[model samples]
Target: MKFKTLNKNSGKDKLHSNDVIADFLHEHLEEFGDPKEDILKALNYVFDRGGFILLGLENKEIVGAVVINDTGMSGYIPEHILVYIAVHHNQRGKGAGKKLMEGALKLCTGDVALHVEDNNPAKFLYEKVGFTNPYLEMRWKRKQ
Candidate 1:
């Protein structure tokens, strides 16, 4: 249940690779079908642009992860977007997800935002972790 910032050269970062991330996504996508390449692309973009935070063992096995970005749109006040959050199926009921989120929130300088589909069961967990429903957005991607 230890938490650490994934250093570039650290063994922890090795667990954050595309293959592992994709595998976790694939396991979840069985009900959602294969996700588009763009999804992985977006994940890579977030990893690069948002600075990823991972939750796992001190030895390098990742149990959960969260990606966040600074939304440039400015007006009222605090701002940031929680681009993605995922807890490995094996680690779901445990506090890995919440610990990862708390780590993300601690690093955030302002209010954060994220989208969750109405049908996602994780929505309940999100709410339990203090996220609120703000609005709805849709995605339209043509089949490859």
Candidate 2:
């Protein structure tokens, strides 16, 4: 497997067309519904702000992708957040996700953060990559 960071301007399009990302999200819509508009918006926001997108490929085919943001929080402290990640179901358990995460970490200069649902198996992967759960507050409100 090979890991590569894609150009921010083109990453979103590549991800949207990737068989792995589209198929996995479609197959698991019960868990990650087909929120195409939302996903596109998130991708655009990341790219617009000089964020990073990493891709994991094998045989030139995309197996996984991760979107990260480098929010310059302060001198010596940039907040890196993994906004989205997906690995092909067929390619799961094959270390593709780990490679993608590692690639993202290489670009982060400070604290890194990501949100995983309580039931998301990917949490284990994050932990394995040296990310620890931090005590923090999060609140959500549905748009009116």
Candidate 3:
């Protein structure tokens, strides 16, 4: 597998690749509503926020994906946050996820912050890569 970075432009332009990454994340995390448009909006938000995507590809297929978003003003010290990561269920045992994270680390200036479920296997990969601190991942729940 090859890991590559998709800048904001390519991430937004490549619809098929975007869907593969977005759908994987949606199925694994279940963070968004069951609507196609919602996924598009989320990807657009990532692009608008100056985030970049790291993708693990095999035979031109997206096998693993990671999204990194930087917070704070541009051109200075910013906190890079790992927004979402997903490896195709069939591709879990491979090192695609690790390669994606490593790629993100190479792109960031300092330590990156990300949160994963206690039971998620990817947590082990994060710890293996030295992200061994506790962090809270919080989000606003829109009242229905």
Candidate 4:
């Protein structure tokens, strides 16, 4: 598989288009996925806040993709948050996701963090990649 990263400085003629990347995530992520708009927003956020979107390609098709955003801080928080990662449904259990994650992690200068639903099998892969759950996440959403 070939890996390509798209960031703020990436040119217009990237190997894969943002639409392809967003569609791939929305499709492969299944029940754990967010809407395409949110994915697109995250993809755009990388360019605004300094991060990269990594794409895993094989046979000229996108087999997996990972979106990571630099949190712009360290010590008290991880320096990067892996926002999304997904491998094509037919490509699961074939190490494409792992390779994508590994490649994404390699691009980071400090600690990386990601959220996984408790029942999501991908949690195992995250743990295998050296991510530990050290705290329970609590959030307060503003009422609309």
Candidate 5:
């Protein structure tokens, strides 16, 4: 599979748009994904703040995708947060996800991190890709 990286300056038309990438992730991430709007917001963050979007394509169709957002710092926090990663259901087990993960990791200059639920099967893949659970995350959400 060929890999494509998109940034704010990438062409706005067709497959280059954040809308397209968001749609692709929304569909491919299945039960593990957030809503398309949330995915779009994250995609926007990469372009507006700092980060990147990577696409794995085979025969011009997206087999997998990744989004990484730069934390804009180092040392205390990971330099990047792997915001999202998903492989097309039909493409799973074919090394597409692994390739996407490795490709994203290779592009980053500093440490990268991601969050996964304990029961999410993808956690194994993340672990296989060298992500370690060094700390337990706690979040306090405000009532809407």
Candidate 6:
């Protein structure tokens, strides 16, 4: 397996646009994208801002992908956030996801952060990669 990075100007020889990344996220993550268009827009914005979209591949087939933002507001320490990640269904339980997460963590130059669902088995993998559970996430969405 190998890891590659994509930027705003990166070619599509390996993968297409943010839409492709969003599709991968939707496949393995619940509540990933109710209206995927929103996810695509968000992804493009990240790319334009010099963020990262990393892909994990094995012999030219994508096994996993991760979205990371390395910069935030000005005057800050530029801590990175691992916002989204997923491994292909057929590729799970074989350490592809763990390798992807580990590679992303190592690629970051600053502190990295990510959120795992309470019941997500990937929590173990994240821990294995040296991530600690430091905070609880709370969310409130306006009723539709």
Tell me, by TM-score, which candidate is best.
Answer: 4
Best by lDDT: 4
lDDT at position 62, candidate 5: 82
What clash count goes with each model? 0, 0, 0, 0, 0, 0
Which model is ahead, 3 or 5, in terms of TM-score? Answer: 5
Instruction: Evaluate all candidate structures by whole-model CA lDDT and list the values in order.
Output: 0.63, 0.68, 0.70, 0.88, 0.88, 0.73
lDDT of 3: 0.70
The deviation in Å at residue 78 for candidate 2 is 5.0
* Alpha-carbon RMSD to native, per candidate: 4.0, 3.5, 3.8, 1.2, 1.4, 3.0
Taking all chains together, each candidate's TM-score versus the true structure is 0.69, 0.76, 0.74, 0.95, 0.93, 0.79
State which candidate, 1 or 5, has the greater lDDT: 5
Residue 8 of model 3, lDDT score: 66
Q: Residue 37, candidate 2: how far off, in angstroms? A: 1.2
TM-score of 2: 0.76
Clashes of 4: 0
User: Model 5's lDDT to the true fold?
Assistant: 0.88
The C-alpha local distance difference test score for the whole of candidate 4 amounts to 0.88
Q: Taking the tens digit of each residue's C-alpha lDDT, what string does model 2 give over 66-108?
A: 7677676745544776777788788888877787788888877
lDDT of 1 by residue, 3-85 (tens): 65542224335546666665665564445424646446645654455444454553576666565666655556346776567
lDDT score, candidate 6, position 112: 76
Candidate 6 residue 108 C-alpha distance from true site, Å: 0.7
| Candidate 1 lowest-lDDT run of ten | 6-15
The positional error of residue 127 in candidate 2, measured at the CA in angstroms, is 1.1
Predicted candidate 6 versus true structure: per-residue lDDT over 50-141, tens digit per residue: 56778887787677888887566434433777777888888888889888887787777778777677677777887888888767768999
lDDT of 3 by residue, 1-144 (tens): 877777666645454466766776677554422355565555666678766777777887777777787675444433777777777778777776777778878888655777676777778989888887654556999999
Candidate 5 on 116-142: residue-level lDDT in tens? 988888898899999898898999999
Candidate 5, which segments miss by more than 4 Å at Cα?
9-13
- Count clashing pairs, candidate 6: 0
